[model samples]
Structures are given as structure tokens and as C-alpha cells.
Target: MSGSRPAATATAAAPARPGGGMRPGGPGGPFGGMAGPPQKPLNFGPSAKRLVGRLAPERLGVMLVVVLTVVSVALNAIGPRLLGHGTDLIFQGIIGRQLPEGVTRDQAVENLRADGQNTFADMITGMSVMPGQGIDFGALQSVLLGVLALYVGASLFMWLQAYLLNDIVQRTVFRLRSDVEDKIHRLPLKYFDVNARGDVLSRVTNDIDNVSQSLQQTLSQLLNSLLTVVGVLAMMLWISPLLALIALATIPLSLIITTLVAKRSQQQFVAQWAHTGALNGQIEEAYTGHALVKVFGRQREVEQSFGAKNDELFQASFGAQFVSGLIMPAMFFLGNLNYVAIAVVGGLRVASGTMTLGEVQAFVQYTRQFTQPLTQVASMANVLQSGVASAERVFELLDEPEQVPDSTDPATLDRQPRGRVEFEHVSFSYDPDQPLIEDLSLVAEPGRTVAIVGPTGAGKTTLVNLIMRFYELQGGRITIDGRDIAELSRDELRSNIGMVLQDTWLFGGTIRENLAYGDPTASEAQIRAAAEATYVDRFVHSLPGGYDTVIDEEGDNISAGEKQLLTIARAFLADPAILILDEATSSVDTRTEVLVQHAMAALRSDRTSFVIAHRLSTIRDADLILVMRDGAIVEQGSHTELLERRGAYFDLYNSQFALPAVEE
Candidate 1:
């Protein structure tokens, strides 16, 4: 899943790779590129408890399900007893019919005892067998009907509980999804900067989905199985304690097998999800910069990296499934063994005449009931482990620190103040130890253009980020109209400023709508006017749909210059008090740039503008040009004044616009 995209560093001290650089742990680097290092699985008990706590809001629903399940299990437990009662009736009638018609039940038993048939006499004495009766049809019919009613009632209650459980689980997962979405928005931008975006997305989407599926599939069934075990065990003991012991003997073996298998599979399941997130991250990175990847001829390397991560995921998944899959077969084997033991013991008891055949039959039925639930529990071990693992990843995302809280009481500003910005002794660093911008002070008069010119990694973009409060300052303050910007709410401060970055981002909408995004309340005529001023109208009209041409998500339908023009048009539509243009015209050709420059002139006429540009010609008319190097202002003056000084700015200008050598 991994590919080469250079990560944000503590400081951009070196030139970035021309295209997205090859990611580390590629075929050329060390292994484990997909995910950093394998993480240990979260403790099962704590994670499972935390996951279960998500159902607290559905407490009432869960309680109802529990009650229904108990009712179902109780009713199911009564079935064997009614069946045993009916069996006794048939057995007694068959035995009684062969006895003398005048003989009492006690007389028949005594006769059998005198004939040295004590065990047979004991069996005969246990049932109410009338000597003349062949069968008790009336009692037998009532018992059979009772058994049917009990079984039907049990099934109905089970269905009701399952229906309610589905509702409760879905509600819980919905809330979980909501919480994760809110958390994603609230998280600090640095989290996205430092972490793999694909991994984060996988946790939010894929992990939560897995958790939902597992809960939906296994939660109710597991609950039912446990309750069934308890109810059936009690019934078994009631039928014959000796046979109940035989059924209980295999339970220890089932528990031991489940525990050992679950423990090993827990690590594999954790690995499976971790690899999934890493693979997702890689895929996202590769796709987002696929053009750059191909342009740089790193496709082979990226594919190798992807293949490695994918293989890791496959291994983890197979291992988890294979390990956990062992539990069910082992459980089934033990369950069958328990059945055989119970049947043999029950048969011996029935033959000894200590227990009737009817009792032995019911005991055998209880044996299956008891072991079946245990088998169910064992079978669910893999699901429970995988679900818990996915849930833990979700919890990790939810637990990430959020952005700093906004000021409780925000400062109010005038409807539209003259944009006078001042950076007073400001200092900032992406990392505290590596100071990028230190005590950088500047004053931008109202309705003035302050152009910042610098080499890459001179903190040009970082300075803009600081001004926007996208990041906090390490020292000093920036102010607007003599009021500290920190005192203003982020929304209010940002509303006064409009930014057009070098990169163009267009929505998947018509060109008209994209332009309207700069000011949602703008009228149609105003949107067209801005587009015309920035030359967006030129190419927009050339398209078949003109202003209504829908731009795709990537904006690939339009040329790069056209896309850049549209962004400029959108920024022009905003008409903010302070405007920022960071390499805003870089993508445009000379003719388009000339046209956009005129549009920019009109846009910045009344606003205080901060323009970060490398093309020295564009800033010749700027009121003041600040020359930055290694995050500090090395020179400051009007462009003409700097050129006259023949200092750092003069050297930079010559280096860029130096005339080409004549052909030899």
C-alpha cells in the first residue's frame, strides 16, 4: 500500500523531491513499509468491555432482549420434561397391559419381585401403570400438545429477542459512526499531516463497518448460547445428576481449546486490521499522486511496495482465520464425545431400573442442549476476536487529541475595517528546536501589497499558515487593524481574509457553482463578472456548456491554467478585507498571467494583500517587498529600491531573469 510521498518535516530545510519521492520501505529500503511496526493486540477484556459500553444508550433495549432470551431458554428447558412425561405414559401402559386384569399395580410389582425380577419391579413401581390399560391416550395427547406449545413459545421469544437485538446493535453502531465523524473534524490538522491519511480513513470507515457486522452477527447469538447453556444444564441435572456429570465432563476441554486458540488468533487479527489500514494508506497515496509517480518512473518501485504490504495483510488474515477456525472443529469433536458418554451412561441407568426409560431419554436430550451452546460459543471466538480488534482501532482514532478549544469570549470587529496588518516580534517553528521564523516583525499599511519572496523551505507557506491560525505561534502576535488576531475567533478572523494557494482545488460541480463558492450569496451576474475579470470566462465559454460546464473532482476536464484561472476568479468573488496569493499565478501561461495580473490589481486596490511570489516581475509594483531567507527577513524595500541596492533581492532577480547565453 505504500508509495513515495514526502512527509511533512519539522522544517523544510532541504529541497523537496521534484515529484512525490519514493516512500521508504520500498524495494530499495527496509521491510515493513505498509505499517510502521506491528502493534500488540489490545487487551481483550478491556477492549470488549469498552465496546460493550457503547450499548449503554440502548440499555433498555438490551435489558428487554435479556429478559426475552431468558424466557425463551426457560420455555425451551420445559420441552424435555413434557416429552419425558409422555414417554412414561406409553411405557407404563405397555407394561400394564400384559399384567392380570384384576391385579393392582402393587400386586403386580410384588409378583415380579417374588419371581426375582427386582429391577423390573422397581421400574414398574416408578410409573402409575393401571394393570388393564393399554395406553393413556388422553394424558399422552395433553403432554404432546404441551411440548409443542413450549417449543413454539420458545421459538417466538427467541425471534423477538433477535429482532430487538438487531435494532439495538444498529443504533449503537450508528452512534459510533457519528462520533467518529465528529472526531475526525475536531482533530488537529497535524494528525493528518503526520499520519497516513489512508490508514486513518480505513479506521474510520472499514474498521467501524467490521465492528458493526461482527456485533450484528454474533452479539445476540452469543447471549442466547450462554443462557441456553445455563438453562439446559439445570434441566439435565434435574433429569439425572449422573448423566449431567457426564455432559459436564467435556466442557473443560472445550474451554481450554477455545482459550488457547483465541489467544494466538488475537495477535493475528490485530495484525490483519493494522495491515489493512497500512495498505489503504498506500493505495490512497499512490492514486493521489499517480501522475507524479508515473512521471518519475517509480511505478515499479511503488508496485513492489504495494505488493509487500498486501502480502503482509494476506498472511495476517490467513493466520488469524486459520488459527481461530480450529476452535469449531475441536468443539464439535468434544461435543460429540460428550453425547456418546451421556447416552451410554443413561442407557446403563435405564437398564439397571434405577431410572425409567423416559427419564433416560430426557437426560439424553438435555445433554445435546448443553453441549450445543458450548459449541456455539466456541464457534464465535473468531468473530469476537476480529470484531474487538477492529473496535480497538476505532477507539484509537476517537481518542486522538482534538484541536485547541476556541476562545470562550471572542473579540468583535468593525463591519469592514481598513486592513492594516502588523507582525510584531513573531516567532514560529514547525519544531520547537528548529526555529524557522524568529522575531520576524513587519508592518503592512492599509491598502498595501506586501510581497514575500523567498527560496523554497524559507517558511513562505508556513508563514501564511501561521497568519491563518492553521497553526499556533511559538512567540509574538499578529494583528489586524491594531487589534490582536488571537483575540478574534478563528471564524471571524478567517472571514476577513481570502487565500488562493498555488494548487487549484475545484468541487465536483458546474463552473458557475465553483465560482459561487467564493461567496455563496453572490448573484449570477456578479459570478460572471468575476470570471470575466480573471479570464476564466475565456476557456469556460469555449467549453460546450460554457459557465455551466461541470468540473469533475480532480478538475481534469479543464487545463491546468484554466483551473488556476477559476480559482483566481473565485478568490476575486470573495472581496475580503485581506487577501493572500501564494504563487497564485504559477500555473498560468504568460498571456493568462498578464490578464490575471490586471484582475489582481483591481482586487488588491483597497485590501491589504500579502503576496508570496517567486516570479520577480509580478511583484515590481508591490508597495513593499520583503526578502526572506531561512525564515528571517534579510532585506525589505520597494522592488525598485531593492534592485537599486544591488543586495540579496538584486541577486535573486538576476538569477531568475538572467538573459540566456547566445548560441556559440
Candidate 2:
């Protein structure tokens, strides 16, 4: 099968003629039946900005998180310095005990003060008065307790930050999902015509899921990691500017590597998600048409197609993961090198008396802390890229064009319409370069049955789309009861017309509920009356639940003909001024069709009805028969009158009976 196999099969199975059946480029059209080519990766700059903008409503919360993160990191950075102070106090006490007996306490203090170490001596002196005494255990205990208190405070702030950020992320995702749902309803039908159902679903389900997960997991970690890096670097500089410079040397190289790897990996991430969506689309299409695939014995073809898409997704996913995986290990090696350099340099500084042993140990700890955040950032690379890619897909969908705006001063039907409809010189084309319907004019007076007949691809269903305002006409005016349809709201206009399509759609509900869909306020007696008129009450009564029988999704619990009858009954219940029966009896048995014809005749006695059917035998009693060819009405008149005229209608009528072709 070709890539367009689904489209061709749908077209052959149920062709949409002018105003009668499904249109070619309407919902579930050939163009949208299958997934198209993969979309290119979106620009990261714009997508990121838009995502940030979506969180504008929670700016105050975000600001509080940032403040808490900063404070938490600052406390964590100061803890090491405080521990170093305890180490210094112990070293001073040990050395003071070893001081020569002849050296006085004042001399020792003055000597240390001259060496620019007055702060250390003063702290130790306050705890220890005797010069030859051992270390001051009390001072050591005090410094250790202070460090513990600082750590506890830091943990509290971190917890608060996490809590606030989580709320922000969840609320943002909620708003985003709501916007997508609203946008789906507002978008024009043409958007669906060119987009696959599964692909659109992927954006709503998988893509949004990715975005939400990434934000929830990555946002807090990202903020904490960044603040930790900055705080560690600042403390390192405060201890010794020279050692801080040495630690900073590895940063430029690590960043260059991270940037190169991230750039390559981002593209793969985008491709991976796109292929995932395509695979989902294929799965949805295949499963929805499983019976058809088996009937045609094309299971192998379907399997091969699925395998191809699956493989593509796997390759893209692997490439993205492998490239991003390189970042952590590479940064780890760089971090180790920085640690070694800082240890050696700090040892040399301690020996030269430029730094204390405690200070050297603290500086080394800070260097380790600095590299840890970089590793964390590297670990988050995959999540961040995936999230941005998903956000791009969602935003693209949200940006789709909606239906044409309603008129500012719209017209309304002054009273209940008498079921008169007119098409005045209407012109339209799905593709502007290929004109379909041109300068067509027609009128259906109240209580008229107008039958439209045409061959395949003759724009039969397109007329119904135009009449329902599913597609705007290029040039023309369609009026109901002398008022232009364009001037009336679509909801009001559609509510006044009832349609029974070739494909019967019944939701998963009780039979009564399905019947009441056309008129929710319909009484139970009225519902039974409508069902009885269309012969639906017979099968419905035979079921165990009768009118309360449950129908599964797709209404597969009932036979196709029974489903069709139910839809016809629904139309009867609606009782609109104008009624459309597009191949309504196609699935029913001959006997059932005859019964339905009788019911329809009575229903049409007081309404304008348009019947589209391929079976010439069924529409012989139509008051007006329109023979359409190449989008234009070639002949139209009463069934007998058209037969006598022997025009386009005669040829179509005779051809159906397998009679000799008659010249128009």
C-alpha cells in the first residue's frame, strides 16, 4: 500500500458528494488520514520566552522561591567557613601549650597580631587563659553547634523553596492544558483536514505530559544548582583570590564542551518527539481500522510501516540520550582535575604561611561544591531539551487560526422559518486554482423533497458543507427564509437544520440518550414515537434493556443498519425546519429501507428535505431530482419530467438501471 492508502480507502468506501456526504477536505480528510513528514526543530529562544511568559501569573511566587534559594545557598556556603574557624581554634590551643616557658601570654598575642592573625588568637584567648594548657574543648563545641544550626536553617529554606516552586509548576500546567482544550474547539475545520488525529492527540497528551514532568522536576533543581554554584564561587574568592582564579580556569573549557554537546543533542530531542508523535498517529489509524486491515489482508504492510516509525523514534531517542549522557562524565573528569589542582596549590600556600591549614581545607571543599552544580546541570540537559521541544509543539497548536469571526451586527430570523433555502450564484473551490462549484443557483421551497445525484468526486458533499457554513464560499450568498446565513450565528443556523449523515455516529450511552441528543428536552413518549416512526423501536424493544440498552463506543454493539435507523430517529426527534438525509438508508435492508421511505415521506410532509442517494430506485418519487456533473447542476426537475427531458438526469437514471446510455 502507498502512503495515501488510508485516504484512498476512505474515499472509495464512502464518497462525499456535493451537499450529500462527507467532504474531501473536511475532518478526517485524505490529507489528514495519515501522519506527514517530521517537523523541523523549533527555535529554542522563542519557545523558551513564550514558556516563561506563561508563568507570568505566578511571578510573585517565583520571586519568593528565588529569594529562599539564595538564602539557603548562602547559609550552606558559610557553614564550611564556620567549621574551619573551629579547626583554627584547636590548632592555636595546641600550639600555645608548646610555647616556651619564658614566652609571656602578652608576647605571644602581640607576635600573632603582628603576623595579621589577631582574630584567631583573640577567639582562642577568650576561651583559654593559660598559655601552656591543652586545646579548649568548650570553644570547639560552640563552633560545631553553630555550624549545625546554620545547616538546619538552610534545609528549612530549601524545603520552602521546593514547596512554592511545585505549586507554580502545577498551576502553570493546568492553565496550559485548559488553553489547549479551548483552542481545539475554536480552531477551523481546515486545520484538522491537514493534521492527523493521532498527531494532534500526541500534542495534547504526550507532549503536554513531557512539559509538565520536566517543569516539576527540573525547575527547583535548576534554581538550586545555579545558586549553589554562585555561592560556592563567591566563598572561594573570599578565602583566597589566587586559588579562586585557578578553580575558575576549568570552567571555560567545560562550558564549551557542554554547549557543543547540548546543541547537537537538542536537535535529536526534537526529532525524537516528532517521530514519537508520528508513531502514535500510525498506531491510532491502524487500530481504528483493524477490521479493514484484516479484511484486505494487509497486516504485513501495516507491521512494516509501524516498524519503520518505531525504529526512527528509537534512533533519535538514543542519539539524544547518548549525547546528553556524555556531559556528566566529562564534567566529572574536569571537576576532579580542578580538585587536584586546588589541593596542591592550597598546600603550597599553607607552607608559605599565606593561608592557614584550616583555610586551605575550606577552600578545597568550596572548589568541590562549585563543580557539583555543573554536573547537576549537565544531568538535566535531556529533560530541559525535551521540555522545550514539547512546549514548541503545544504552542504551535495554540497558534492555529480559528473560524472566521462573527459579524458585528448579525441578523436573526424574525420568526420560525418556513423551511425555504436558496443558493444564489454561489462559487467556491477547495483549491482556488481548481474551481469546483461556479455560479450555482437553486431554491428548495417548504415541504419539497430535493434529491441530488452525482458520480464520485463530483462535489456532491461540498454543497452540504457550504450550506452548513463549514466552509466559506468564495463568492455567493446562501439564505434561509430570505436572510443570509453569514449574518446569523452558526449555532443558531445549525440548530434550525437537522442532518443524518452516511456514517452514523452514536456515543457510548443508553439508546434513549442517543435519541435525545437531537433534542435533549424531548419527552420519553416523544422519543418512542420518533423511534417507532423510523422502525428503531422494534429492535430496541427486543433488547433486554429496551430503550435503555447501552451502546459501546462506535456503537458496535448494534448492527450497522440498526445504528443508521437510530440516527434517522434522532433526526425525527429534532424536527428541524429543514432535514437532510445523506445516504441515510444505505446500510439498512431493502425491507427496512422501504419502511424508512414511508416514514421519511410523512416526516417531510411539512419540512424542506434534501435526499442524496445512489440507488435510483429509492428517490423516484422526489419532487425535484438534481443531476450534478463536475460541480454544476446539469439537469433538475420532477422524476418523471427529467425522464421525459432525457438530459443529464435521464442519463444518470438510465445508467443506474443498466439501460443504454442516453445523450443529454
Candidate 3:
């Protein structure tokens, strides 16, 4: 986001349209005038890797999570095996030969050893059973208790992992948001000029939110699921390699299906978010300009346009969700097929005495565990892809080109500035092929008014932008107090100048807060003095809350003229050596304009002032008047001097006084 505003030369070749081609009064213009261009899909692998790199600062927490996940998965994997051992003990006790009543346990064990049933006798002895009893209920109870402990421990570790991961993910999101905020201040104004306000806001708010949510919900689950799959596969192989191979056969099929679905779903997810941003842009534009829509009878048109965008969002979201939704069920079906194959093959192995019945049960359990994580991973594909897409958007914003670098060794004003401004042979163009302000030269000594009068698109605003260093000059230099502006830091240069634009901007704050914005350290006496000078104190006193009145975001609590006066008061409070008034009085009533002019005259008495006005009558007494046409100074002189010459300024001044004749 470059800081410089594009020059008028770039817009000259464009077709002439109202509101600069913004669809101001129709359905197509709902998204703050014009819909932004389509977005391209982001690369998933690189984006995901970049997102992971952002977590590098939390390495300790991530390592802890990895350890906990491995421990938990190991415990879970051991549970079924332990249960199977308990089952084997119970089966042995049930099938073991019965002994004579009251036979000594040692004698029964010796008899069983003689009968080739020594293992069962040993089991009976371990349980303290007298062999008269059939099953070793005591030993079975101990094995069950061990299995319960494993499960409980696994649950506890999983809980701890979730807690730690949440902390890390939240902290990472905090850093990302902070970086975005800082980047916003550094971005050039040109970025904003070409981008939608709501779209940029979407990246800052919606995209970041998506990234946070997905990381919180999916990151830990993804890790745990993958670990579980690996652990289960290892356990299965330990039980029986053949069964393990059969179970593993389903993996490639699942991967093939998941990859295809994920590819299609990711594309849809990207589109879904893009349309969502567009809809948000539309809502912001419609709501911000609600009054204009109603006054222009464009309410129906706006609604129709909004509905179209809303429908697009619906389709894209539905497509993404529906495609990703197929993953779990498909994995489940494959899992069930694998389970059947394992059960049949393992039953044969059990019959052939190659594996015990207890081991077969454990192997089947391991197979289920293996498929479960795959299913879970498949289920999370949607979230992961959406998160990656969102991350791509956020990284794209952070990657925008910043403002031009400041000079390494900057120059400063040698003494207090006298407001002497000079534009020496300054040449510039938004595009290299078409020059706008070519070889322009001007000088305004201290305490003089330079009034610039021009037709629309005559580069009046561009000239002021150049003076303020909002845009760098393509050639030559601008100097203030004989110091080149390019050599001065933007902050230092702008601090010495004050501007009150035609569009008054006031944040959502008390009137007093807005007045004190230019100089926060201003005393109450100074604040009141500035307000009184601009005649804003009259209205301030009239309001029920006085200066403390809370203005809304749009500052609609006050009339346009009152808002203008408050801005004037703000500029006056700054007391800069140079001031810019861009049609500052154009929106005020005649009485209010007269008062403001009086205040402005006093303010300009000791400062270099540049006034751009459409109404020529107000600038009659300007120290020097410049008449501009086609991006050039056609005539420049004092009011009387220009009128006597009867050139462009004469024709322009005379046209305003011309009256309509009565029609026959």
C-alpha cells in the first residue's frame, strides 16, 4: 500500500463519469460504489508453512504439546492390549481344569503342571484362588484397573495439550494483529485509493478471525490425530504384520479421495471468503450511504445487487462445505471394509494358533484406532484449507509495499519557518508518458494568500498534495523556508502545516476532544480561544452538553456548517506557519460563511495560506490569484490585474454574474 496519491495525469485518459466512475446511484454500486476485482486462489503449501513459521516464537509450548500428544497416544494405544490380556486371563480361568474341593493351592498347581496346565495354575496362584474357584476374579480386576488408569491418564494429557495449544495460538494471533495494525500506518495512500475500505477491513478483521479460530480448533486435533494414526499402525504391526498390511491397504485409497476432494473444496473455500468480503463491502457501502440510496430512489437497486452477492456467497460456501463434508463418511466406509478384512483374516490366524484370541481382539481395536484418526483428519480438511486461504490474505496485506524510504541524513529548518513556500520547476505525472504538472513554478512569501482557481481536473488538488509531500515530485524540488521538503521527514514537514478539507472529518468523540486533536496539550483557555475565534463556541455553548457532547462516528450530531467550524477551530489551535483551505467554506450558509471568512482572514494574517475555491468572488482580495486550465497556469495576477486583462479569469468571473433571460 503505497502512500502517495496517484496523479491526475493517469486519470486524464479515462472516460469522464460522475463520482469518478463510482456507481453512486444504482444496484451495481452497492459495494461502496464499485465492486472490487476478483481474487486469485492462494497456494496452500506455502501459505500453511508461513503460518507455521509464525508459531516459531512459541517453540517451548509447541514442544510440550508434542510430548504430551505422544504420551497420550501411547497410553491410548496400550489400553486395548491390556484389556485383551485381562480377557485372556479370564478365558484361561474359565477353561482350566477344576481341582478337588479344599485341595491346597500348591498341590493343585503341581498337579496342573503335571497335566501341562501350568500357566493357568500360575494365574490361579497369582490371584490367590484355591483352584476350587473357576475364574481369577481378583487378577482380572487388577488388569481392568490398569486399563482404566491408562485411559484416564490419556484424557488428562489431552486436556493439558488443549490448554497449552490454545495459549500459543492466541498469542500468535495477537502478534499477527499487531503487525497488521502497524503495517496499516506505514502503507501508502495510493493503496487505499485503489482498494475498497471494507475489503481492507475484511482482511484485518474477518481473515484474521478465521485464522485464529482454525488454529485453535484444528491445530491440536490435527497433530493428535496424526500421532494416533502412527501409534496405532505400530501397535497393529506388533500384533501381526499380515493384519497390519491388510489394514494399511486402505490408506492410499483414502489419500487419493481426500486429495481430490480437498483440491476442489479449497477452491470453493477461497471463493466463499472472497464473496463474503464482497458482501460485507456492499453492506458497508449501502449502510454508509443509505440516505443517498433513498433520495435517489435506488433502494430497490441496491437490494437487488446485495441479493446477488449474497447468493454468490451462499453457493460458494455451500459448495466448499458440501465437498469437504464427504471426507468423514468415505473414510468410515473404507474403515469398516478394513475392519471386516482384519476380522476374517485374524480369525483364521487364531484358529491356526498363530495368534491368540486376546491378541486378535487387540488387533481389531488397533485397526479401529487407526481409521478413527484418518476420519478425524479428513473431517478437519475444510477448516485447514479455509485457514490457509485466510492466512494468505493476511500475509498479502502485510506484504504490500510501504511508503518510500526517508533520507538517511535528513535536513531540518535552520530557524523558525517564515512560511515562505517555493515550487521550483516541479514536474510530475501519475504515469510516465503523460505529464500533469510540468515545469510548474510558484512562490508565496510569508503572510500572503495564494488563491488557486481551476476547472475540474485542472490539477488544483494535486498541487496542494505536492506541497504537503503527500506525493513525491517526479522532478525538481519543493522548499519551505529555503529547506527542500524532500530532505525533511514527512512528520516534521507536515507538523508545520495545517489543513481543513472540504470534507470535514471528526472521529467518534466529544466535541472538546475533536477540538483538542491538533494539540492534545492545549489548555482549556487556549481551546476556548480557538473555538471562539472560529465562532464555534457559540454553538458549543448552545448544545445541552456544551463541548462534551458525544458526536457519532459520522459526526451527524452537528450540522455540516458546525462541523466545518469545528475543523477550522482545530486548525487554528495548531497555529502552524502554513495553512491549506480546500473549499473549506463551500458547505456553509451565507451568514456562517461570512463569519468563517472573517475568522479565516485573521488566521491567514501571519501565515502562508493556499486557498482552492470554486466560487471566484470569495478570493477577490487574494494577494495573488492563479487561474488554471488543462493542468497549466493560464493566468496569474491580483484580482484587479486579472480582470483588466480579460483573459480566462475575466471570462470565468463574468460568467458567474451572468443571469438567465426571460423565455418567450
Candidate 4:
């Protein structure tokens, strides 16, 4: 028996992937994948900006981190200069101890210059040396202590900055998750119908985790490295502009490497995640329908699909990781080049006495600091690219068009309406090009059991969907008690209606909890009464826990009949004015079906109910049985009346209930 899911979902031309849904850091492949129309380009700039904007709520925290980092970087920048002074102190002290007594630094310099020791004279020219004084431990100790203090302050501020940055990144990611969750609820059912569930799930769980983890890994380091570069470069320029310029010469080369590698890596990362989603979708579909796959002997095809998807993931991940990985090593190589140039230039300057040994030492330190941060930023290219790709996926989901907002001042549906439902020239189509229902008008009188009988895709469920307002109508209106359903909020409208589909869904909870889901305010006696009415109490009383018996996720403990009974009981507890039953007894044995039918009769007492049944026997006693043919009511009457008319209903009845030909 086909359940009409395809036609019910109403998906027409959305480009949904074949299979679906984690990490692809690395294996073996070329450094790229198909980055064509299927995989849209990652909107790095906008996504990154939006990610940054998530920190708006924590602006104060961000400012604190920035301030703390600035202080740390400033202190770190001055540390080497202060350390250079300490070196100067030691050098001056040692030189003064060896010099003649009563001779001043200028006098020593003048004497050295007279002797043409010009470079040596220049080396100690600015040095505070005494001609005859020994190593002055007091002044040396003071300079050493001052350098130590600067370093300690720098470390303290850096630690504080790191501590605060973690908070900002986490909170920002938290808000992103919240936004994503809220966005999911607002999206239309068509969105889910058009996309694979696993893909959407990956966007929520995997993509979001990727975004969070990436931010945690890169945010602090990126901020610190970038600031460190600026701060360190400023110090390098102040110390020796020529050496700083030499160090900077490697920038263009580093940029070239990062840009080239990133271009290839970005595409691969996108493909990697896309493949991850595709793989997940396949896994979800296969696992959920595993029994059907085995019954149909399609296990091999499913396995091959999984294998292909996994291999694609491996290819993209390997490329994304391997290609992006090249940045760090390349950057380090340029840094080494920069490091060598700085050391050589500083040594020459020191030897020429144009710069002191201590000054050259500090300048060399500054060069390493500057190059190191650049290398760090370059190394982060892979992580940044992967993260931005994930963000793009998440943003795309958030940007999906949601259902129109509920009316601000919606009309209210009574707890117990008069129960007259009317479709005035209602027209709707799953796809506009292929209309399913035309200008069809029907009135379901109060307390009537309107049986909608049809073949699969004859819009049997579609009619029910219309009554429930699951999809908006393209023309005309549906009204209950003379009030348009569109004028009421969905929650308000749905609260007065109850539905029990063919497939029963029971969460992990006690029987009592499941019953209470129908109406939270139900009393113990009322719950038991409803359960007894649906015969759920008959089975539950035999179980050890009675109402307290916990249902597993799959509800394996309950028989199919028992599950149906519980659903009916749950619906009974709801006590809705209108009930919609979608062939609830279609799969049960005759004995169970009889019991279910009785319980359904009780549930439908004095209520307007729509029963979508494939079995013609079930709707025989209906007040009005509408025989539907491709979304139109071809005939409408009671079973006896339709049989007399010999119309579509008569044909359907004869097909299902007509006796077989007599044997020869």
C-alpha cells in the first residue's frame, strides 16, 4: 500500500542531492574537486563579517580582550628594548672596569677615535661607561629587574587576554547556534521537502560544530598574531628601519603562496563538507529503510552508494587539508629567509659600530617576532577557509525563505466549535504547472464523519492537509464555524484538531507521559478512562509498570495493535473538536481492526472527523463518503446510495468488495 509521500510533499524541481552527511581533514587525491554550479562559491567576506557581528552582544567582552591584548603586545614590544638596556648596562660595566681610572666615556671615545679605532669608538659612543669603574652590580641588577618586570607584565596581560577571548568566541558561537535553531523552525515544509533531512541536520550539528571549533581554534590566535605583527613591526622599524624593510621584503612572496594554495583549498573544503552531507543523507535513508533494502535485495547498491560518497569525501578532505597545509611550511621558509637577512644585516651594523651589540640583539629579536606572527597568520589560512565554508552553509540555511508570518491579530478558534468545515471553491497544486485540486467546494457538516476515499495520489491526504492548513491554499478559503482558518494562528487552529496517522510515533517516555502529551492538564482518572476506551489500558494493566512502563525509542515492547491503541488513546485524551484519521487500522489483523474501529467510533462521537481509508468497507456507514478521483470529488453519498448510482464509488466498492468469480 503506497502512503502517498511523494505527492504529499509537493516537491517539484528543487535540486536535491542523491545521498547525504563530518570531518574531512585528510587521505589521497588531487588538490581540487568539482567546484562548479553544484557547489556555490563560499561567500567568505560576508560570512566572516556576519560571524564577527555575532560578537555584538558581547562587545564589552571583546573590548576587554582587545585592551588586554594591546597592553600585552605593547609590553612585549618594549621588553626587548628594556632587555637591550640591560645588555648595555653589562657591556658598559665590563668596559669601564677594564678602562683607566678617572677617564670618562667621551674621553675614552675621543682617545679611541684618535687611535683610529673608529668602529670600536662608535660601538660604545652612546654607552654609559666609566673609564676606571668595575662592573657596577647595583645598576646591572636594576636594569635586569626592569626587563624582568616588563616580561612578567606582558605574560600576565597575554594570559588575561586569552582567558577573555575564549569566552567571547564561545558566546558568539552559542548565539550562532541559537539563531540557526530558531531559523529551522521558521522555514517552510517545502524547504525540508526540497532538501534531504540529513543534509539539513549536518548544517545544524556538523557545520555548526565546525564553525564553533574553528572559531575556538583561530579567533584568539588570529587576533594575537595579527596584533603581534603590527606591534612587533613597529618596534622593528623604531629599532632599525633598514632591517625592518629587509624583513618585510618576503611579504609579497608569502602572500602569493597563501593566495594560490587557498584558492584550491577553499573549493576542496566546500566539496568535502558537501560530500559529508551527501554521505550522511545516504546513511540516514539506508539505515531507516534497512529492512526494505534487504527485502528488495538492494543492499549492494546502497553499499556502493555509501562507498562512492565516502571516497568523494576522502578526496575532498585530503585535498583541502594537504593543499591548505602547504601554507605553514611555505610561510616558515619565507620567515627563515627574512630571519637570515635580518641577522646578517644586524651583525654588519654592529661590527661597523653604527649600532650597539645590544641594539642589534633587540632588532634581531623584533625581526623574529614580526616574521613569526606572519607565519602564524599564513598557517591559519586552512582553518579559516574551512570554517568560512561551513559558515556559508549555515548562513544559506538561515537565509531560506520561511513561511509567511502568522497574522498579528488572528481570529480565535473555539475549544469546541460548531464543527462545520467548508471549502469554498478551494484550489491548490503541489506544483503550479500540475494542479492537483481545482475549484472544488465541499461542506462537512457539524458532527459528521466525512470519509475521503481515493486511489494513491488522488489527493486524499491533500484534502486532509488542506483542512489542517499544512499548505496554504492558492484560491478560495477554508472556514470552520464561518471563520477563515487563515485568520487564526496555526497553534490556535491546531490546538482544536487531533490527528492520528497510520504510522505511530512514541517518544522515550512512560505510557502516562505519552498520554499526557495529548493534553498536559489531563487527570490520572481521565487518562485511564481514555486508555480504557481505546483498549490501551487492557494491555498496559498486564505490564509490570502499568502507566509507568517506559517506552524505548523504537517501542519494540509494544505490539503493532497495542501501539495503534495507544495512539487512539492519546488522541482521545486530546478531546479535540475535529479528528483526522489516516487509515489507522489498515495494517492490523481483523480482530485488532474491529477493536480499533470501535475505539475510533467512540473517539469520533459528536465530532467532525475526516477518515482517509483505502478499504471501502471502513467508510460504508459514513454520513458522507466522497469518492475522489485525481483531487476532484467525482461522487459523494453514503455507501448504499453510491452503489445504487453505479458511479466512481460503485466501481471502487465493486473492485474492493465484489465477490470473486465462481470456480468451474
TM-score of each: 0.91, 0.88, 0.90, 0.91
Q: What TM-score does structure 1 among the candidates reach?
A: 0.91
- Scored by lDDT, model 3 comes in at 0.83
Q: Report lDDT per candidate.
A: 0.83, 0.83, 0.83, 0.79
- Look at candidate 1 and tell me the lDDT of residue 270: 92
- Per-residue lDDT of candidate 3, residues 1-664 (tens digit): 0001122222233122112235332334543344643456568899999999999999999999999999999999999999888877776566443566667777877887889985555555543334455677898899999999999999999999999999999999999999999999888755675666667788899999999999997999899989998898888888889999999999999999999999889988888888777777788888888888898998888888888888888999999899999998999999999999999998777655467767888998999889998998999999999999889889999999998767889888744689899877787765566657776677888999999997776778778888887778888899998999999988888889999988788999999999999899999999999999999998999999999999999888899899999898999999889999988888788898888888888889989999999988778878988887656677788899899999999988888887868999
Runs of candidate 3 with Cα error greater than 4 angstroms are 1-40, 97-133
lDDT of 4 at 40: 65
Candidate 4: tens digits of C-alpha lDDT, residues 223-276: 888898899888888888898889889999888988888887888888888888
lDDT of 1 by residue, 174-222 (tens): 9999999989877865676557767888988899999999999889888
Off by over 4 Å in 1: 1-34, 98-100, 114-119, 660-664
Candidate 2 accuracy as lDDT: 0.83
Which stretches in model 2 have alpha-carbon errors above 4 Å?
A: 1-39, 90-135, 659-664
Please give the lDDT score at residue 322 for candidate 4.
94
- The candidates, ranked best first by TM-score, are 1, 4, 3, 2
Q: Residue 563: error of model 4 in Å?
A: 2.6
